[model samples]
Target: MIEVYTDAASKGNPGKSGIGIVIKAGKADVEYSFPIGTYSNHEAEFHAVIKALELCKVQYPKEILSFRTDSKIVVDTVEKNYTKNNNFLPLLERIQELSGHFPLFFIKWIPEKQNQRADRLAKEGIHK
Candidate 1:
């Protein structure tokens, strides 16, 4: 199974935002950061997962995917496969579509400290 850690940071609510992701698959480990224009922190979190899944789709293909994020909203929304928030609906749809490319996909919520690397990358991304 491939392990993925994702995080997002925003300078302010609906402000400049970015996403960070770390992927671990056997001996290959990679880190990624992206300045994703502007969005609220919650939206950024959702985008981080979407980005990670997209990356995995091209690189890992039929691999099993396990994702970790510091955002409970992302974890809950993905586990339940639903979100009532309108802003997240489209992003959620994209995530759902991308995840289906893998043999299996799952996400878990991690504490901030446990997600420090991705957190740092996300903070750095805001300025990029």
Candidate 2:
């Protein structure tokens, strides 16, 4: 099993943004921070998940994916447990489509403090 922790942020609702991801496989931990340009935080969150999935394809193609994120918009939308506002529909659809590629997937919402590493990456992404 592989655990990927992800997070994203925007300076404003529709402003500079970034996506961050931390992948853990046994004793190895890898971190990624990507500048996603001007977008809403929700969009950045989706980007983070997409980026994480892409990385997983290279590093753990056959492993079950368990992802943790603190973004309510992302977690709720992916779980199909909540309705998304119109602004997020496109990204939501993309995420739904991406999930089809995985053999097994799980995404859960965790407390922001518990998702520190990814959070740090996201903040770093903002500046880079």
Candidate 3:
């Protein structure tokens, strides 16, 4: 199983943002951080999940993925397979499309403290 921890940070509500993803597969682990220019916090969160899944599809295509995020909105939205916000529909669709590639895909909401690593990386991304 591949365990992925993801987070996103924005300097402002709809300002500069970045994404952080940490992937752990058995004894191996990898970290990625990238600046996403400008986006809202929710948008950044969705983007982070998308980026993590995209990386997994390339590196661990056939493996099951267990994704963890600190954003309740993201976890709940994905779990329900639906969202009321039209602005996020495209992002949700992309996530659903990406999830289809995995044998199993699961996302859980974690506390901010539990997602510290990803949080730090995301902050780093904001400055970059």
Candidate 4:
């Protein structure tokens, strides 16, 4: 099994954004950061999840994956504990579709401090 940590950040509420991700398998660790351009924090969060899934597809294809994020909205929506708004329906659909591609998947919400690696990458992405 693989454990993935992810986070996203924005300069403003709907300003320049970035995504950060950390993938861990046993003792090995991988990190990625990308500038996602102007978007709301919520959108950036969704983008981070999408990017994480894409990375997982390439790095750990055909394996069970467990993902962690600090975004309650994203974690709740994907976990089906909360309903997504009309504006986010499309993104939710895409996430759902992406989840189906994996043999096993899990999305869990953790404290922001616990996701510092990804959080730092996301902030770095915003500057780069």
* TM-score-superior candidate, 2 or 4: 4
Error of 2 at 90 (Å): 2.6
* TM-score, per-candidate, Cα-based: 0.98, 0.91, 0.98, 0.94
Single out the weakest 10-residue window by summed lDDT for candidate 3: 81-90
Highest lDDT model number: 3
Give a tens-digit lDDT track for model 2, residues 15-99.
8998889999999999999998998888888889988988888788888899999997788888883454876776677766666
C-alpha-based local distance difference test score of model 3: 0.96
Clashing pairs in 1: none
Ranked by lDDT from best down, the candidates are 3, 1, 4, 2
lDDT of 1: 0.95
lDDT string for model 1 (1-128, tens) is 99999999999999999899999999988999999999999999999999999999999999999999989999999889899999999999999999999889999999999999899999989999
Candidate 3 lDDT tens digits, 8-36: 99999999999999999999889999999
Which window of 10 residues has the lowest lDDT sum in candidate 2? 81-90
Q: Write the number of the candidate with greater TM-score, choosing between 1 and 2.
A: 1
> Global CA lDDT of candidate 4, please?
0.91
Model 3, residue 38: distance off in Å is 0.9
TM-score ranking from best candidate downward: 3, 1, 4, 2
List pairs with backbone clashes in candidate 2: none
